[model samples]
Target chain A: MAEKHNIKNPAVKRILQEVKEMQSNPSDDYMSLPLEENIFEWQFAIRGPRDTEFEGGIYHGRIQLPSEYPFKPPSFMLLTPSGRFETQTKICLSISNHHPEHWQPSWSVRTALVALIAFMPTNPNGALGSLNYKKEDRCALATKSQEAPPKFGTPERQRLIDEIHEYMLSKSSPLPQLAPSQASEEQSKTEEAKAQVNLENPEALPVGAEIPDQAGDRIVEEQELPVNANPNPAGVEASMESSSSVSSNQLLQKSDARVQNLKPDTRVQKPDDRLFTLAAIGLAIAIVVLLLKKFIKSTEYGAVFMDES
Target chain B: MKFCKKYQEYMQGQEKKLPGVGFKKLKKILKKCRRNSSSQKPLHASLAAKTCPDHCPVCDGTFFPSLLNEMSDIVGCFNQRAQKLLELHLASGVRKYFLWIKGKLQGNHTALIQEGKDLVTYALINAIAIRKILKKYDKIHYSKQGQLFKSQIQSMHKEILQSPWLCELMAFHINLRETKVKSRKAHALFDGCSLTFKDGKPALTCELFDSIKVDIDLTCSICLDTVFDPVSLTCGHIFCYICACSAASVSIVNGLKSADPKMKCPLCREGAVYEGAVHLEELNILLSRSCQEYWEQRIQTERVERVKQIKEHWDSQCRAFVGV
Candidate 1:
């Protein structure tokens, strides 16, 4: 019946087209129903944005388009336990009832869904379609919702989401240069440094990486050595000189490459080289220190020979 | 000057031939004659009426025919002397007397002119003077009526304010902020009423008729005459279970069942009356203390009458058997 209706109605045709496009290139944070049956009624699951109380939440709601659709508008009802609005209540919105005149016929289902997701976490007073909830309560709900099973009434709805998720994951290709193991190693080094400083306790490690594990213990030992083993003055001086020289050489190489790329008309290249010049001076200082160390060692050996005589 | 001298000589010769022709009367005749002579010369006279004829002095186009006819009737009512005086007054400077009178007529001062004499004559002369002023003042009158309508609306607002319960309820549940008491009385004044304040705001907003469904029970729950505080439970069961315990004066040591948890719910026999049952709060709130007492008294009287009727029936049957 819906297929027949879609064929007959121009508006249904446009809505179906938009739905197909949205499904083909689905956003990571949004999920929508498929276009097969009952195009007037749709369900969506939206992942909340970061840094908000609703972050990590997968909210579920139903959209009901009026029979005159596109020309009229659609209404929405939230089924999940979102703290902002009462569960299972139809919320009034500008696109719904607050301002029917502003509703444009050209606006698609995807546009409404995007707007609905973006409008979450807004202050509720006088805001059409916005629900008010305590920040703490919302944050708690958001955290709880992360573990909730992605349940839908029909297999079609579930399958649609599964397909979209698969599509998005496929599209998000891993960086070629940064291998998985190398990324983990860099992550672990930062974690070890953080543990040493005790800004956040080491016990609160990433999930699946237990605190008492052998790998965690080795990283902790490495962090401790920087503060402990480098206490000897001569060894510390040699290590510092070598580290400075290596860092300076890296900086000089970066600047040389930048200077080659810079056009003659661009007068700002000198400022870009300031860090490289500082690195060069640091390298020169390290070289001087090494020479001085050598000279001191020779003098000490000479003094030892005279004593022996 | 020569033409004027010739016209004066010609007029003197005519006067001598026709005796007793005074200069003032002759001049009046001459003026009439000149006006008549010009009108008789038909140089596009048919076009005269077509070219802006019957133009309203006030509006500068064809006048509203009905208003002009009415104005002419008013003019006709004036005596010749008053009409002359009005024309003279209009010809001089002022032109707003009629408009002022019209304004005063429509205003609170309307009654004052009705009580005065010869309004039509006075209106006509004054009407011409105040024509422009009247048009301006008519707009003012319209605005004043608009203000009056606004004040009437404000008075309606005050009426709604008097019953904040009805006002708030209508606003919350029905979304109707303003309602007339007369209309409400006409629509919803019935024997039973329901009270519901479900939204947590202190306003009762439920349909009284729809919510009042309860099965009949023989025993009062409170006075146990039949459940006096008949509350419907969540399980869709209603009983005067509380009334029964309170009426029996069962001690706290003796539980609700001691009075009767075995008491069947009037609506559903499967359900039994138990402790900690939820009382339909809306119904309880609506049933006033006095109304409850009246109902209890009425029920007891009806029970006594029923027993008397049964005794009379049995006695008559016994008498008939003895006679046989």
Candidate 2:
């Protein structure tokens, strides 16, 4: 593969890197390979996103990378009639060349394929080369998608697609044994239930939204809620300080008192005492004083260093 | 002597302003804390404690706070200096124009040179320090906290390269390169860093010291090629303008300015980074001046790509409106 392409070209070098990475970290979700004749042209098979009508589907697509490669987003055309996107047409997606302004050079073919799978279940919103088929139609197409690889393009491209489909099949199990009628019935019930949950709490529905639109303030409010809920964050913080001071040995007695006040857990207290004893035996000098103080504090041994600095 | 003294002064001033103790004092305290933590780890390891082994209150509460505080202080000071340097450079044009009208036109080359040289030195030393500390933290913790903190630093606009003024500094050096002819001393002091296209990849190598050389790759993380017409997102990741626009979903008509405020930086995943994207015009100028042929080719191709995108976008809009 290295000898076949001109390694001197930066685009080729990057494409080769992606090819190498894809081979090494083979994913169960999707499989991709560049065309035999052109390194820029790739064929891929992606598992349908779960929990959607498209589930159990094996969608095949072609990726045509521009000469500049990573600098430019690739054009994606799905040959399979998944019902989400028009067959044999370049899909206008944020991750595709049709929306080149949304492409990041850092994103590789792997990332794009993952994004493509994720986009399968979204409301196309009249995006160019997008289709909004009925739920039943989509499910029917999905089941059909896995029956055979869509016959398109050259025989070489078709062969690549077939191999990808085979690989995807081996990675996944046969779709759950469900009568089509019963499966559709269950799906409709779940869909209605999902709508009820969304209507009850519109906030929870964003989790299922394709593009997460989390406002900056909402995140800050979410973060502040925990702090607000925990009334003794300062006390928890003070315990932390005292424990650190225990290691530093400057204000051990003071910190120890505060630590005891905050956390009276004898079990939690035991580990620190044990750790100090181990340190005293190993180092024998600086921590010996700390260990002795802790021992005295633990045993209430005449309050020797307790009154002293 | 003056440049070195100014550099030290700036560093000391920055160190003094850090929360809690001064930088040197914090450094000493952290050194002791590190030693104590190292000693504690083996003892902790020997014991069969079911508690979280990695948790160390002393290291986390005391050592990290001081180190991170000092790091932020250094970054904040560098940003201020960079801003000041830019202000001075920008004002020079107005000052020069006034002088020309008064028939006394002369450049303030000395101040620009001094500020530029000091800024570069300051950036090199402070950047090295930050990298070293992060590396040490990661080494000691056996975690990638240092790596994660870097992105946090960037989001805060405290990243060294994130400053828009660095672009101006690059322009200053480029101008110096052309005008100064072959003054090796000036080049040595001001041009401590040089952009090289070694192995057909762009890398900026900075000779911070005789023994210490830092090489920063200039490859667009999106494209794995030399950055062309670079723009810096607010999160401080540099990418080609077109690439960034594509990532943010902002069309050429609206520009990056109108990109969704929730749009996250592709590199750091920091939201709203696109809204404040800096064009890096000066760096682009410097790049174009140095690599004329590559610049020409890129500009030609980019023009064609941009026009094609505009046409396609309008066609889509027409189809949507006219129902064709």
Candidate 3:
């Protein structure tokens, strides 16, 4: 829950801001969240952007935030079995504090996530911890990423996979929930966490239900905390999904100001749709008028119909 | 020093000329135009008209054509500015290096730092101006053409950063940061694969830049990081030499510029790339000048990589050919 965070420290504050942003308005291609126990250390699962060798892969990774916060850039490591990067090694990138001179203070965790996704398909050249995986091998690993959770992290991280699943399930509507197949994917999402990944796009994310929170820091996910030790799927009162969306929708109305910021295009799109509908109606009315005038002039409708037929 | 002063003034002078299009003003105009058309209740009837109401009220025939010309002018100006900035940096670099060589270097770093600051300011300002111009163009066109325009301007930033002048400026800053650590090895190879001149004198690289503020435009599109050992292809798209070669499927041993007729520019994906890629000499110079240590460390790292690549793929082929 958002209220549980300690927002006193700037590092915590930034981490909370970033986490809350990612949860509500997630990148359609990736999912990342900080652990309830440690805000500084985050667990992330990224869908390799489509049209690349990494396509269809759901990569799990960790982001360790320095206490210095945005002033210091974060380090990123991929944990999934993607052939491009050796699993669990700190990736050498100018954007990743590897070249501090290149780090811009304006960059945030969201920016870094974006950079990471974009940077994956590039030829490794000679970057530290990069691999020149064959295209076939990468595609094979990408397929395996969907079914297998990373073997590296702790069990709690395995639980976080389920959390990532629920987050994806609740946020991206077109995507089918991978949590059901989480058993084969390596763990099961029960009362605590549940998920698997869709290999393809469902067209779009859930349109209006996303709720953006300004981490003054009380944000609530659900009555359920992200991590639950009690793994009884049946005992839960409301279904895991039904409750998550309900809380998200409730928060939607409460944060109307911030919600608009999340979906800026929605406001512009409304007028365009209305204009289109108005134009279509006018065309329909003009055609009807033309038909009536012609029919009346021709006298008998039956005669006109017989001639037309 | 006079030229540096003039370049500084040029940025300040250009500021008002390129005063960017305002977001609020544009939005307000668009809203007013919509309201006027929609006030007649049956909105669709007007919309159904052959002329259609979405046409921009701001641009007439002359205006749209003029905007394109304006876009070119801005791009040309930035390119020219970049060239001038490069000249100033190179001139001063030569002056500093030769003075050091002659042992007459009076150690007045203020002028050097000034030039570096001026270069950053002009590049940044031109980038902003180009973005504004592109955004205005897109808003008027109501299409993704603005993004295309933005990329064109962006390539300039990419080019300017490649200039030998920036490389010198960068080296100056790198030295300032690590005053305590003597550069451990040969000239710092920015991308590590670059061939460094052995026993070459360390040129005038100090006091130009102390702040490591990197422009986003300076980033290599492939690496998503600052461009290093930058080389521009025939298409004018710039990239780190290693990145460019890798993307082109050419090995570092073969080099990007070597005869590879079938090779095409990776970003454009269709344009026939020249057998000879333009070595971003100015940019490489900037890299060697700015941070010799980083450049050197990278060279070491890439040497290991080159060996690995050869061992993994090329070594066996050579052995087979030689019957070893």
Local distance difference test values of all predictions, in order: 0.40, 0.63, 0.51
DockQ of 2: 0.06
For model 1 the local lDDT of residue A195 reads 35
lDDT tens digits by residue: candidate 2, A1-309: 211454435476567546644543456677787775677898888888777898878899899999977767899998889889998889999988887667766789998998998899999999999999999999999899888888988896777777777777765544333346977878767766664453334224221122112211111111111332222111111010111113111222222223222321111225786786566556755577888889878776556556664
Candidate 1: what is its chain A TM-score? 0.49
Candidate 1 wrong stretches, greater than 4 Å? A1-3, A126-130, A149-309, B1-324
The deviation in Å at residue B240 for candidate 3 is: 3.7
Each prediction's DockQ against the real complex: 0.00, 0.06, 0.01
Best by DockQ: 2
Better of 1 and 3 by lDDT: 3
TM-score of the second chain of model 3 compared to its true counterpart: 0.46
Best lDDT goes to which candidate?
2
User: TM-score of model 1 relative to the true fold?
Assistant: 0.27
Q: In terms of docking quality, how is candidate 1 classified? A: incorrect
The local distance difference test score of model 2 is 0.63
Inter-residue clash pairs, candidate 2: A101-B245, A101-B246, A102-B246, A102-B247, A103-B246, A103-B247, A105-B222, A105-B223, A106-B221, A106-B222
